[model samples]
Target chain A: MESVLDIKQLTMDFGGLRALDHIDLDVKAGEIAALIGPNGAGKTTFFNCVTGIYKPTEGDMFICPPGKKRERINGLKPNQVTEKGMARTFQNIRLFQNMTVLENVMMGRHCRMRAGIPGAILRNRATREEEQRVVEESYAILKKIGLAEFVNEFAKNLPYGAQRRLEIARAMATEPFLLLLDEPAAGMNNQETKELDELILRIRSEEKISILLIEHDMKLVMSLSDRIFVMDYGRKIAQGTPEEIKNNPAVIKAYLGEDIDA
Target chain B: MNTIKELKKSFLIALWFMFLTFPIMVIKVNTVEQTIDWRWNRLAMVGIFSFFASWIWRYLLQRKEMGQKRAEESETPTLTFQQRVLQNPKFTRPALVVICIFAAIFPFYFSMYQVNIMTTALIYVILGLGLNIVVGLAGLLDLGYVAFYAVGAYSYALLNVHFGMGFWACLPIGAGLAMLFGIVLGFPVLRLRGDYLAIVTLGFGEIIRLILENWNEFSFGPSGIANIPRPGFFGIKMSIHQSLIYIYFIMVAMVIFTIFVVRRLQDSRIGRAWIALREDEVACQATGIDKTKTKLSAFALGATWAGMGGVVFAAKTTFINPASFTIWESIMILCIVVLGGMGSIVGVIFGAGILILLPEYLRAFSEYRMLMFAAALVLMMVFRPHGIISAVRRTYQFEGSPEKKASS
Candidate 1:
């Protein structure tokens, strides 16, 4: 399988504190990969580094869309990273609170849209047609995400689970080849977590988009992710299939405690 | 019991107010005659007004709380009166026609002084709308907006004196120059946000004014440039009355054009990018909005209107001076945008009308003009922080689903 996102020895340092240390990770095309660790394990920092919020101190980061040439995307701006077909959701929901749900999704179509000030002012036939298409496309994405009922409602007004799903839907609207979700299941109940599990699987299968999610919901991660990467104290401790990670001693020690026999 | 308690609270508030206003309101100093006059009746008036004002304040607060609670409880919040009027074609179509008719006949029906005052208000309406793009929709606090106004005014004034340029030609030139200045200012301050941005912009405004004040060679110093020609009507000369009316209609047409462009921009992709940028800078960038481009466009576009307004102002007064483009002018324009709902066009027009025309009309009570203005602003802040009409997000009506089409 072709790797959609490949990171080689990525290192991020904040002064003396190393947030992400020489982590090698990759998400294969159309695969759901999980990055799991305890609290403050630099999972979010890793996501930030990859999504161009933070520049990695040392590493090569490359992205290859399905059937496309691999392109190095290091030191790009966050918008540039997104434009390069990688999109991410925050651990904390960052929906434009004042904007409507449909508007929020429409915002994701911004990079792809070509209408400028003149187009906006004139509302020429092409601009109008493009705008209509965006609205319909955004609505379709919302419908698929089950947020159609709250389409016109302000994003802040949506229920918590819906806001989380709205974040994913917003990311999906970017038409990313690689979707990075940071704690999508956080603050969600079991029902929401189950739905999120199904949503991730559906995204991978139907959309053919590779997903790299940082999640604390172990059951959802274990069930959904084809491969799992474990991090501890800014280092990648282990990487394997869900069953292997469940029994890995290094991951176990990092997560639970050191084995007494050892 | 509650009503009595409320009365007691109001009574205490009124007493405090009276005490605070004692020296200023009740005691008048006759400096020319060197006598202190004790106005007992004035004190009583203050007490009476304060008492009722306090009661009304608390009542409004209670109503606001109730409205908020009700809004949270309901699925769809009830539309405000302004929103209803704006949304329903039944009200809007007739109201618009009536307004147009009124605007057309206003100069003929009113005195030249009244027409002049209305023109000033219309200029403010344009400035308020222009600033609305940056401060309201883009969520950028631009304190030096009047600098762009000055740029426009001076561009026309300088070009006309040096090269005999006409108002029609200078209109775009001034606007373009102001946009250039906006882009120039936008570059250095691109990294700043909120208070810092405001402080820098404030300084930028003062700098522009000071430059005009001190640049004796370029701007003819503080004495300023005079006798700039008004917009011509096909080389046909007319009386002052006829010209004033022509200028008024020109402003009216400009206001319409501004409304058309601004309203269209508000619903476009770039507009959404701006609002999104205002909402969350990080998320906006992450969603693929070019922050630099959006912010610069906001500055550039916002300045464009201010520039146009400045040209009109120069032509109207037939004068251009540094004092005209003071920090206070910028603050006044900011006040107009804020007082009107920040992002709403109708709100801006009403805001400019009330802010500009109210003081002019209140010349009879000139002593209390600023007092009333400040008091109204304070009251507005307390009651409606979002302005007279908070900007309503455009709702895209969803047609039948694609699935439905396939089935049909």
Candidate 2:
């Protein structure tokens, strides 16, 4: 299987403190990979590094958009990383709070669209048609995420689970070859988690995009992720299928007796 | 109970007013002999009037609040007949048409003095709209926007004096120079946020002013460039009144052009990117928005308008001076944007009108003008902080009833 993302010897340091240390991770094309770790395990730090939020102290990161050439994207800005066909959702739900749900998704399509000041001011035929297409495509994404009813509502006004879903909807609008979700199931109830599980599955099958998620929900992790990489203290502890991770001794030790099976 | 509470509030308010007005209002100036006179009677009258005024205002506000609470409790969400009529396109569209017609004919009825005032107010309206693009839409607190206005004026003045360029030719050049300055200023401070950004911009504004003041040969060293050409009508010189009317119409055209452009930008992709950048810059970047490009576009676009305003101002006043582009001008423009409600086109116009016209009408009380303006601003911030016309976030939905299609 061709890998969509490749990270080697990734290390990040905030002055004296090392957040991500010598991590090697990969997510193959169309595979849902899980990066599970205990608190302070540098999962989010790794995501930030790969997404160009932080420049890794030492590492090589490469992204190969399905049919595109593998490109080294070490020090590219976040938008540049996104332009290279990777999109991500934040752990804290960073939707454009003041904008409507549809507008948030439209923002995701910003890089895909091209309309400068003159075009925007003139409202030429091409600009008008492009804008119309953006509206329709954004609405379709909202409908897929079941947020079509609340499309006009502000993103900040949505329920907790809906906000998470809207974040995914926004990310998906970018048409990323690989989607990175930071705790997409965080704070979701059982029913919402079940819905999220199905949504993630549908996203993989229908969109045909790979997903790399940092989730603490074991049941979700076990059922959804095709492959799981366990991390502790900024290093990978184990990598295998869900069943192998469930019985791994090193994973159990790192989780401090919180049974992976339970 | 409510009456007593209102009385107490009114008393405190009256006391505060008395403290503010006693020295300034009670002292009368004798213009002829330069003698100071104290008018105790005037102080008492003002005190008594303020006391009653405060009490009445408090009572009315409380009643309005109670009425609003009752309405909210009912939760019917239906508009009244008046509101429905106001919202109707038939009424509003025609109303807008009428207003535009009135504005077009307004200068013909007014005297030169009134036309001049109207022109000044319109200039501020343009300035307010320009600043709105940066501060309101992009959430960049710029305290140095007057710098761009000065740049435009100086550009026109220099080009006309040195190269003998016409008004029409200088307009674009002036605006382009100002936009260049905006980008130059925006580059280094791209990393700064909030108060820090404001401070840097404020410094940049001062730096421009100081350069103009010190650069004797280029800027004429505070004497300013006088007799700058006024725009002519079809290669013919006109009388003062005719010129005033021409300038008035030109200003009107400029304002309309500005409004049309801004309205279009607000609904477009660039506008959405600005709003997104304002909301969460990190999220914008993650969503594939180039922050540097977005911020630079905002700065440059905003400066473009201010530059045009400066060109018009130079032509109208026929003089260019660093003093005219002072910090106070920037603050006034910022005040107009804030008082109008940030990110609202109509709000900015209304805000500019009130601020400009109120001071003109209060010319009799010129000494107390700024003090009263400051007090009113504080009161406005307390009562309606969002502004006189708080912007309603507009959403664009797909055409032809997507809701119906989805449900079916």
Candidate 3:
């Protein structure tokens, strides 16, 4: 399978502290790859670096859109990275709190839309039609995420689990080829985690997009990810199938400990 | 016990009023002798009246609190008559139409002085709406907004004097210049947030005023550009009365145009991006919104309206000066936006009307007008910080209930 995301020697430093230490990683097309680590393992920092929230100290970050050429996207703006078909959710929920769910989702479609000030102010036929399509497309995505009923509700008003799902729904609206989720199941209950598990699988199969997630939930990481990369202290310790990762002595010592069931 | 509590509240209120009024009431200006005249009787009357007014105010407030408690105990929400009227389109739509009709005929019924005051109030409404886009919708606290108004006024004044441009031609040119200034000012302060943004903008406003004051050759210095041309009625020079009415109509048309444009922008994609940026800049960027572009657009669009207002103001007053575009003017415009609920069009209009007309109507106490204005603003901040009208956020609903649709 062709790799959708290629990261090589990605190094990020904050003065004396090396937040990310020359980590190399990849996610193949339509693959669900999990990056699991202990606290302060720089998993979220890695996501931030790749998504252009932080300018890396040094590295090559390449995104290959399906059936398209591989383009280096290092040092790009966050919005530019998103325009290049990479969307990410924060470890903490970061929805536009005051905006309605539908509005938030529609914002995800912003880069794809081409209406400028003139088009908006004129409300010409083309602008009106384009706006209508944005609404329809955003609503359809909301329905797919089972948030259709709360379309008019403010993002902050939603339940914790629903807000998390709304984030995914919003990211999907970008029509990204690779979706990056940072601890998406952080505060979810078992039922919500189950629903999220199915949702992630469905997203991979139905949307045909690769997913790269940083999660602490070992069960979720083991069950959902096609491949697993274990990290500790900003350094990758092991990379293998979930089965191999579950038994790897270094992975157990660094993160999982002795009990695989736990 | 209740009567005693109410008495205590009234006493405290009366004491506060006495503290506020003592200097103003006790010292009277003797215009004839050019000396201060002690007015013991007037001071005594003021004290007595304040005591009674405080008693009445406390009584009313206590009754309102009691009513609220009773409503809470009932556990059934009931809309007040005012709220019901505001919500029902059948009443509100016709009421608005009637109001508009009356507004249209007001200049004919009122004297020229009253008409001029009304025109001034309308100008403030335009300023309030323009500032609303920056502070309310975009969540950018711009304390230098009056600079744009000054830019527009000076642009038209200079263009008319040098090139003999008509009002129609100068309007767009002035607006464009103001927009350019907005972008220029906005670019440097794009990274600043909150208080820093406000301070920088305030500095920008002062910078513009200082430049206009000292730049003698270009801006005509402190004396200002005088004998500016007035807007014409199709090549006909009318009498003062005819001119007042013409300007009133021009102001009305401009206000309507502003409302229409602002309403359209509020529902557009760009508007959503602005709101998102306001809510969370980081989230906005993460969602693929270019922060610089959005901020610049907000500043430029807001400045555009202020520019139009300045052109009209220059035409109406037939003079332009650095003093007219002071920090006080910016604060007054900001006050209107706050006093009307932020992000509310109708609120800003109502706020402008009250702030502008209240001073005019209180000419008997003209010396105390600014004091009263400051007091009222303080009271507003303490008692009703959201202003007279809080903004009603727009929502989207799936096609279902008519009531939901109407409310949304």
| Highest-lDDT candidate | 1
Question: Best DockQ goes to which candidate?
Answer: 1
Off by over 4 Å in 1: A259-262, B11-50, B400-408
Cα shift from native, residue B248, model 1 (Å) = 1.0
State interface RMSD in Å for all models: 3.1, 2.3, 2.9
Q: Between candidates 1 and 3, name the one with more favorable TM-score.
A: 1
The per-residue C-alpha lDDT of model 1 at residue B196 equals 97
Give the higher-DockQ candidate: 1 or 3. 1
Worst 10 residues of 3 chain B by lDDT: B74-83
Off by over 4 Å in 2: A257-262, B1-88, B397-408
Docking class of 2: medium
**For every model shown, what is its TM-score relative to the native structure?**
0.95, 0.90, 0.88
What does candidate 1's lDDT look like per residue over B1-408, in tens digits? 289999999888889989999999988999999999999898888989999998987899999988888889877747777788899999999999999999999999999999999998999999999999999999999999999999999999999999999999999999999999999999998889999999999999999999999999999989999998889999999888888999999999999999999999999999999999899999999999999999999999999999999999999889888999999999999999999998899999999999899889878998997788798889899889899888898876666543342453
lDDT of 3 at A251: 88
User: In candidate 3, how many Å is residue B300 off?
Assistant: 0.6
Is 2 or 3 the stronger prediction by lDDT?
2
Docking quality (DockQ) for each candidate: 0.64, 0.58, 0.46
lDDT for each residue of candidate 3 in B35-72, tens digit (9 for 90 to 100)? 99887887667767877887876666666677668765
